[model samples]
Target: MTLWPGLAADAAAQACPAGWPQWDAFARRHVQADGRVVDFSVPEQQSTSESQSYGMFFALAANDRARFAAIWRWSRDNLGAGSDKLPAWQWGRREGGSFGVIDPNAASDADLWFAYALLEAARLWQMPDYLKAGMALLGQVKAQEVRVMGDLGPMLLPGPVGFEAGRERWRLNPSYLPLPLLRRFAAVDPSGPWTAMVQGAARLATQSAPQGFAPDWVIYDAGKGFQPDSERSVLGSYDAIRVYLWAGVTNDGDPLVAAVRNALAPMTRAVVSYAAPPEKINTVTGAPEGRGPIGFSAALLPWLKATGAADALAAQEALVREKWQTWSRAAHPAGAAGDGEFNYYNSVLSLFGWGWLQGQYRFDAAGQVTPAWACAA
Candidate 1:
């Protein structure tokens, strides 16, 4: 088992940092006072449910209840997030220059994360309101997001609509199903299809990566197995990076961990060969192209450590640490990192990757979060 810093009273003497400076920096750069996580990189300056969900999870992990409540409020007010409605996936400046929801469609992954964060927060903070909201939202997820495929049993679609390409063909994003969350849901909602989803998720992770490289999106035929998505081809890039992150941070004792890790072994080799993860790859041919962004390096940290690629992990750690100093740590006058306007996604990735390395938090076998303070207490 990984020994998290501050797990013991003497941990402070071991020179662990006082708090999560990275998360503090992220909040300043991306999160607004109104608790909206705006991506200033794009002209729309969009706020997606994914961003809000990530914000809530990070806040919970940092034990910042006030910020958590604020973020939840903004999402509830703007994104239509509540027990009765699945949060709208995207909000931004509209064509008329007025800010509003750009897309009414809900992203199932964000829905899961939102529910997970709320459920965990309720348990950790002993708040019944959070629990009530979480269970009700989870009910919506079960009703709308899950579908019974021909033989795949209960599989999670990417959203409530538009993903079912045909009567028998369905589009799936493998990265959306984090094993840890599935484990937690299985424990919390045993009567639901969470257990069956766990098994299906394992197949998605392993079978989708026939060449040991996960595709950004895959097509699942009712009778046939997984195939490269027609729209996305065989490419793996931004969306697939989270697959490694999810697999890496999953508790080692989970029965499906080894299979998922083995399926993603090619990523480790690519990182070693190029000295960093590739920005994109042809999942079918195992051909890589271009050096990935700093966020890609950050995304690989936990996976490298988990896979025992010590040298690769060191290199990525060094690169991330070096580049991290280039960005400002305070809220800028323009409400975005000037040159690092694209920092929102990278920062979230780092929070998950470097945060794990720094011992800020961890996931148990049942997918319960173990924040550093919780361990110390």
Candidate 2:
């Protein structure tokens, strides 16, 4: 058995510092006092359900009970529209600069994250309300987001509407399905189709890439299996980076872990050959397009260390240090790091990557999270 990196004792000594400082600063800067996680990089400075969902998860991981409660309250009040159900996907400045939920469609990815975060938070913090909200939101997702395909069983849709490209074809984002997250969900509701989606997504993450890198999105035909998405370009960059991140951080004991690791071998090879991970790759040919940012390095930390790719892990670690000087210790004007604006996605990637790098948290085979502080528990 390939034993993944665990929370080291010395590392645990610095566990509090090993996590959430960047996101904390990020929350202070971008998350308004109103609880909105505003992405200042965008012109409209919109806040999506994705931002809110991820914030909840990060807060739980950071063990920031106060921030988690605040974010949930704001999302419930504004995004919920008093419905007490799934929050709308879009909020903040719209086309005419009006602030509200411009679109009410619930994003399945965000919904899943919200539910997963809630369940995990409840366990970690022993909060009943979080568990209640988590189960409620999960039921909503199981009813609305879950769909039955011809052969794929219950697959998750990108959103409540759209993404259905044709009568026989549907678009899917490979990066959206993190194995650990899916596995965690399956554990919560074993009778549901979450396991099927887990298997399907695992197959897609590996099968779609000839060179072992995942695509941002792909078309899943009922009979043809996975193909390149027509609406999006054939390149994988921002959206696909998480595919690797998800695979990298998964607990080693998972049955799907070895398969995902083997399927994403091209990423390992690329990180070794180029001395760091490529920013993007051709979805079909596995050809390198450009260099990735420091966050890519952060995303790879777990998988590298997991697979015993010591040199690759060491190389990416060096690159992460070189790319983000404040990576080791939170240093920045919150999102305005050096000349570039704060990358919301990059920060997210770093949370998982750097969190593992510092031994802050790791998922077990059953998908329960083991934070550094909770090592005994």
Indicate which candidate wins on lDDT. 1
TM-score of each: 0.94, 0.90
Off by over 4 Å in 2: 1-20, 81-85, 326-342
* Full-model lDDT, candidate 1: 0.86
- Taking every candidate in turn, the Cα RMSD to the unseen true structure, in Å, is 2.8, 3.5
Off by over 4 Å in 1: 5-17, 329-334, 337-342
Clashes of each: 0, 2
Per-residue lDDT over 1-377 for candidate 1, one digit per residue giving the tens place of the 0 to 100 score: 33453234343222233589888877877788889987777788899999999999999989988889989999989998884789999999999999999999999999999999999999999998998888888899999999987777899999998999787889999999999999999898999999999999999999998789989999999888788886757899999999999998888878999989998899999999999999899988889989888888888888997898989998999989888765654345434443372377887888998887777778888999987667555
lDDT (Cα, tens digit) per residue for candidate 2, span 161-272: 8888787778878877877778888888888888898888888788777667788888888888778875787778888888878887787778887888888887888888
